[model samples]
Target: MTKPKISIVIPTYNRADLIAESLESILGQTFDSWECIIIDDNSNDNTIEIVTPFLKDKRFKFTTKPLGYAKGANASRNYGLELSQGKYIYWLDSDDIIHPLTFELCINEFSWNIIDFCRFQRTVFFDNFDVKCFDNYNIDENVFFIDKSHIEKIINNELPINTCSVIWKKKSLGFEKFSNELLYAEEWEYYSRLVSNGLKGININKVLIYARKHSCSQTHEFNCNNYIRVEAKKEAALLIVKNLAAKKMLTYSLKRYFICLSIGFKEYNLFEQIISTIQISSVEKIKWQIFYTILPLRLSLYKIKKAIKM
Candidate 1:
């Protein structure tokens, strides 16, 4: 009945199986002053069955609609915004969950500083933690102090702060709008906008969220992995050419170059993929542009790592 300080938004589709655990985690949170909003993208499953019990709490609600990720997530967020009396917003995917005390702790931590957003360090569960985070190209960064400058450095340096481990003020939505065109690169593009709007993010020294992975996910479905590493770099170069055409600032040019290089050298073994994608002069020209494409055949074994999908 009381107005809350935080609104937790979840968007799901056919997640009847895992939704309960996520809800249970929230219900068990030590923080009592919060509400949860679930936006069902017109699922045919018992997702409603899983959420039905929580309906009595004025804090819990749901919306059923036919929407995919880009539109679905944005619509759900806006829907939560309309229902929420909270000044702060937190988004959790239906397949992911919050720490038992996450809302309580993060809200308390918000008072420590005025921030546009906060990013969490993740602890993934890949058949449990015994295996290194590297098993799936997932990383768990150590607790460290990060402020606005650090975030700026991260943005410029090509490191990322993502939505899973991310929370931000509900008000910031008014300044910059979410994009509807992008399904995959939305995070990168959105973060770029948030930063461009002068909103700063900090890394909370806590493991606040868990990102789940399975064969059905985008990571597993990324059919371009064979060319992903190489294509990523080519994408960077193309992005740069576009940036120059658009006359955008070159502040991160070096960073972009390395990102392109990193993708080409470390992420893919795609000579044929390159020929198919790029029509830039001769093979020798491509080699001249690339620093290490000329490495010995035996060295091809070095760049075979893939990032964990969440």
Candidate 2:
């Protein structure tokens, strides 16, 4: 088989019902020089039976996560990255579907420009709804040149980039991999490291992917495991904060932003991790300590005020 120009790596769990749609979308791509690798994360459901038909196409390959490997999308994604044999990488989820022209449009942009990656817009579609009911999550910028300010904006949520909406130049990624330990915001943390390393890219300004929001999705599951989700965020924030500090791009607002992510969680040790990781004056440290101490009381007062107004 000839080496493909693009590789679509998808990590899936118990998505037997929806995995076929994602595979079909890939099969219908206008651009043909691509391979779709589906990495299964030990799904007990009939996910294998659903994906088997698609594997008849030479471009569609499927593999199961090896024993002893962690049971999450991060580990599966890392494995897919390892097995990929393409110049560009696009990570898709099992439950989502991409537009037929997704590959063609993004590939054209890469051919015309020198970039480490290309970012595109994605729409959020809920279950039991028409495809036309999707909502576009647009980024406010077009050209995302890697710089201190751009990186800060991403960390500050001013420029939100979705994982499925990106096509990454594999060589530009080097040895960077997702944090397998994190179950939430793993993409945010991984992308932060990539941007901080000075990878420049352009935004395509088109919605090429439809991200499914359903009860079974990992993001939705966070509602039940709130602590697990926040802990993951804290871990991801620590890595981002330390990376920014090392790059000398750490700012007061950025530090405050990450620190505040753990504010209401009441995890003192995790909060201290961020506080100690970033360089701050002793006086500022005292201020943080005071704020953390009174956080519960402050939250209670705010809740009371809100209740009274309501």
Give candidate 1 regions above 4 Å deviation: 66-75, 127-148, 151-159, 223-249, 252-255, 258-310
Q: Which stretches of candidate 2 lie over 4 Å from their true place?
A: 128-148, 290-310
Compute the lDDT of residue 170 as modeled in candidate 2.
96
TM-score of 2: 0.88
lDDT of 1 by residue, 150-174 (tens): 4334444445665567777788766
- Using alpha carbons, what is the TM-score of model 1? 0.68
Q: What is the TM-score of each candidate against the true structure?
A: 0.68, 0.88
Alpha-carbon deviation at 287 in model 1, angstroms: 13
Clashing residue pairs in all predictions, respectively, total 2, 0
Worst 10 residues of 1 by lDDT: 126-135
